[model samples]
Target: MMNGNALHTLKALDPAGGSQVHASPTDRERLLANVLNTSRPAPGPAAGLLRRWRWPLAGVAVATSLAVAVSTYTLFGPNAQPAQAMTPPPLRYAPGSESPRAVLERLAVVALKDTSRVPAGSSLYLKHQGWALSTRIGQIQVTSAIVPSERETWKKADGSMRWKQRTLPPRFQNAHDEEVWSDAGAVGEDPQFTEDATGPVNANDPLNRPAPEEPRAMGKWLLASQEYAGTAEAFDSVAAHNLDELWNGRQRAAMLRFLATRTDVTYRGKVTDRAGRAGQAVSVDSAYGGLPTKYTLILDESNGKVLAYEEELTTTAGALNVKVPSVISYFCFLTARVD
Candidate 1:
């Protein structure tokens, strides 16, 4: 299976394939207005008569409207404020604690340290299902920071000086150069490469390795999923950011609307220790592509921040001897400090 980041990269490269485009807000509003107007009945006899005499009764109508508005405000507005102003969820972890959110945050910080410099290379060893998948794989990590030609120096907390620099070999300057380097004897032509003494070696024969294909563009459907995952009405918004960028176009919008309008959501709460913070876990059931889906959200009871979330979806298969599993999982983690 393709890794999530790789899948995202492929999708970005192929905008015409499966990409989804969302309807604009104006379009959505127009559709809603059309539905409402079509369903509404024409004015009745009394209403028509009132409309004809509306000009003469304008002052009386205004006074009546003001009276009703004041009455409604006095009766309902004050209580509504308290409900509307309810406190938000708490942070997932206390700065000094060892919660799962803290652990993940630390991991993210470490990962970012290496990834912060664009065009820089690093080697990673990954294991799956208790088996070593790769001893070492070379990666060219990029960041939002623009690449700079000059080296920069910084002092470590311990007072040691460190320097950072990035330099690409003459033959590996551009995409074409990178492609050539990917196919050279050092890296071979394999989609998967293993680090050798000289660098990463592509396991597949150069002649057999195919060029990477462009990814399909995400469409309305995927964007809907993102929106569904992003709001307080559905899953925790903060926890859903990780999945938001992975989806695009209409799918995101539909997901958001679905999450906002759906009323079938049920929440069940439990207490658990995550990372190391005491947190409350809430479970929600929903649907995706008409299939049953579940979301598990863990929120810090004190700080109101979501610590983590997990989403699961059902799957099925047709023809072939394929064994389709009933569940797919997505996850996110968060952390923060408490005063």
Candidate 2:
């Protein structure tokens, strides 16, 4: 007769794998009696058998428990939650992703949605500040002077308009430069005021033309209005310089869309304007001049506002045998209050 303990162990392990070790209660009792009453094995042999099987039996029990626990968890475990789909992060601004033309096109779409109009009799006031490069008499070195100026204009439908300008004294670098500037009296600190006393009458002024609301028409008008529209940069400069004075809501959209059709407009990343305002930088370069020059415009992304317009004398510009980067002029539109 086999050991009764071994039979019970076999029954437990083979419960589902194969036939049962004890088919009935009577068979199990008979086997147990045979093991207890018949041959008592040597004590040393029994001890050796228990030692050999103890660790293996414990390992099997642990493995079975683990399998059962994993299946239970997969089916119905507490605190188990379904997996969630991951979301991607937002896209960052990359210059290579879109051209400046594309960027302006997108902004134009947003601008055209605004149905707000400039009220009748509204005045367009622009504050301009920049430095002008000047060489002092009897001096070889060049210096710059700050020039602060402003313009106010109320354009009427009939090309007649009222215009005013306030000029300020130019700031010089040193006493010698200041003396030269004073002696020359290049610009005076005077408040100039003027108005169109002539009432509404159609004149042949370019401002009198109907506003262009399409890209091709706007481009044609811009090019025809320029005295030297030889390059895209020159045209772009004209657009930037006259942006505030030229267009309103839908007209501005047309101008922007026109810019998109130009291939020379380049995206110049982002920068802070001279006024320390953050904006997207764009520029057009023209070698049409004797020297290379860059006309840069910074536009506020939030409101489609032109923050600043700059003209930089590139390193290619040589004067007095000196080639250096200099700002020829800049105009920053500080504020516009409705009248």
Candidate 3:
């Protein structure tokens, strides 16, 4: 018998709010598979993520698209490898010789030296390879499926953008996980929610604007975007989470300059990101998504562009099935260009 709690949560996925879905044997099987393959919209501004997800949504149905949500899939081929074997080792954190403030200030200087400028009407194209954990909860079992994928986006100053993301082969920590994926029928090529569309940008996003080059203005912009309490540390969290939304070198430099003002950000030592690019790492601890997580960003050593960002659980797993100190989500940026 499914745990009453799991059954209850699965019941929440029903578009009609029907309990019969979990009671029927055929429906149960379908729901089990749906947990792995459902897809949602790409992330917008750092909305109340903790408040947003009361339940796991890996392959679950939403109220708006009942048929499509239930039928979606995150395909993975056989012969998936362990995530560690597939990617570079996690960057170790040590106290860098330079203080976080000094490093940020220095990076701001180097970043500004870059002469590359976006044309008045050109779009910013960015491509990154990364993975996020897809979780499923049962009465006695909590499973996380690591889905590695690539994303490419063309973003415009007008807040219009289009992107396509495709999942690569899924990875696991152990054989039991492979069993779960194999049982989930991972034989397809299309990953769910992989689509392309231009947009009326989320105008409310603080970073989704004319990215100011002035450090003080940039600081205010970052603060305006914070969904958390208004504090210096919260400002750090906002800067850490919104790097993907920044379009150009100067804007990022302004961001680093703003971070330099806050005394809370820590300058972690150098690291080779998952993509094998050398970067300087800095981190801030945040209670994001209601979980104790350490968010780290690795910036290209020379150019100061963001190379990767990762979120790892530090103390508690909360409702996550993953172990403490586990990386829940990570992304390695491959290319950013103006076109």
**Candidate number achieving the greatest TM-score relative to the actual structure:** 3
Better of 1 and 3 by lDDT: 3
Candidate 2 pairs with clashing backbones: none
Name the best candidate (by lDDT).
3
For model 3 the TM-score comes to 0.65
lDDT of 3: 0.58
Q: Each model's C-alpha lDDT?
A: 0.30, 0.49, 0.58
Mind giving the per-residue lDDT tens digits that candidate 1 earns over 244-339? Answer: 112122323233233323344333344443235465554456543233445555544443334555443324322211123222222223221110
Per-residue lDDT tens digits for candidate 3, residues 81-195, read 2222112235676557899888888888889888777777666776777654432111101122455667677778675777776656666657876676466544222454465
Lowest summed lDDT over 10 consecutive residues: which window, candidate 3? Answer: 135-144
Clashes of each: 32, 0, 1
Query: Which stretch of 10 consecutive residues in model 1 shows the poorest summed lDDT?
Result: 128-137
- Candidate 3, residue 247: the lDDT equals 44
For every candidate structure, what is the RMSD over all alpha carbons to the true structure, in angstroms?
Answer: 29.9, 39.4, 12.5
Ranking the candidates on TM-score from highest down gives 3, 2, 1
